[model samples]
Target: MTNAKTLGQAFDVLLQPDKFRDYGPNGLQVEGDREVKLLVSGVTASRALIEAAIEAQADAIFVHHGLFWRGQDGRIVGWMRERLRLLLTHGIHLFAYHLPLDAHPELGNNAQLGRLLGWQADGRFGDQDLGFLGVSTQPWSRPQALADHVSAVLSRPVTCVGDMGQQVRRVAWCTGGAQGYFEAAIAQGVDAFITGEISEPQAHLARETGVAFLACGHHATERYGAPAVAARVAQDLGLQHRFIDIDNPA
Candidate 1:
């Protein structure tokens, strides 16, 4: 059995949560078993995921999105109460990593996305260096071609805005609900900007800016980090790890 504290400490060192200012707490949200034998990883710490973890006989649940956001209601009630009740009832530890997971060079969402697309990461830009600056291996001459490539890579429908015929090679990306970073992407002068979610204003901005904007699903883009980190944790801690992916359209 792997000690939860040992695993959590190692994970913190791996991610360096102190380096980034995150929206929510980074690690060990709900403490469960001190000895974590069966650890499960997922994108979010939702009720569905918790139930899956319970069914899998997981001692701990590691995730990207955990309980309690910056502005969310602190009181344990409604859905939040239900989620916590299930975890507490089952003695399942809940560990979450947010911005740190996104910023990690190897296991991060941006880096994984880049690897999947075979794009070379030149550098980091935007808020807290969360935005990835990269280029496709071969320049996609048409915007539609790039969109098609993204859809193929992520295996999900993408919302693309801007001229489909425009040539794009230089690209910048920030995964999951980063539509606000479009201006920052524009400043980088990238040929395209890719993110998880998009707002209505961004559609107009994409039209006006001439830079292609691709809204891949928020869940699709961020599904890599948690499992990657969790796997590493399992390896380091000598614990059995399983990744439970609950379907998320968004």
Candidate 2:
């Protein structure tokens, strides 16, 4: 077993939460056991995930999305109470890393997705440098082909907005509901923009701007980073770890 305090300290050092301004508190959102023997990672700290982790006998749950958003009501009621009740009752530690998990160059959602898609990242842009700007290893002569590749890699159908045969080279991506950053991505002159979620205006923007757009499921795109980081931490601390994937269609 590893001490939760020590593991959290290591995470703070590794992730450096202080570097970014996030929507929610960055680390150790809900404290539980002092010692962690089995650690589980997931995309969000939902009731389903908490119950699954409890069933799996996980001492802690590591996640990309955590409770207590910036503008959310602070009361422990409704869905929040249900989630917290599970964690508290099971004495499971909840550790969340939002922007930090997305921004990490090597193990981040953007980086992992880039690696999976065979994109060569040259730089980062957008808010707190959360967006990745890259070039596809293989020139994409058709938007549909790129969409197919993304769908294959993510195992989820992708919605594309652009000419089917449009050629694309430079690409920009930011995982998890970062459609607002498309403007910044457009400013970068990327031929295509890939993000977790897309707003309605983006369809018009894609058509008018002649830049391709793909809404690749927020949960699907952001699933890799948290588990990778969790596994790394568990390995470092000599604790057993498993990634509990609570599939989200969003």
For each candidate, the alpha-carbon lDDT, in order, equals 0.90, 0.90
> How do all models score by TM-score?
0.97, 0.97
Candidate 1 residue lDDT tens string, 98-166:
999999999988888888888899989988999999888989997778888889988999999987767
Q: How high is the lDDT of residue 142 in model 1?
A: 79
Write out the backbone clash pairs for model 1: none
TM-score of model 2 vs. true structure = 0.97
Clash tally for model 2:
0
lDDT of 2: 0.90
In angstroms, the error of model 2 at 152 is 1.3
Q: Which stretches of candidate 2 lie over 4 Å from their true place?
A: none
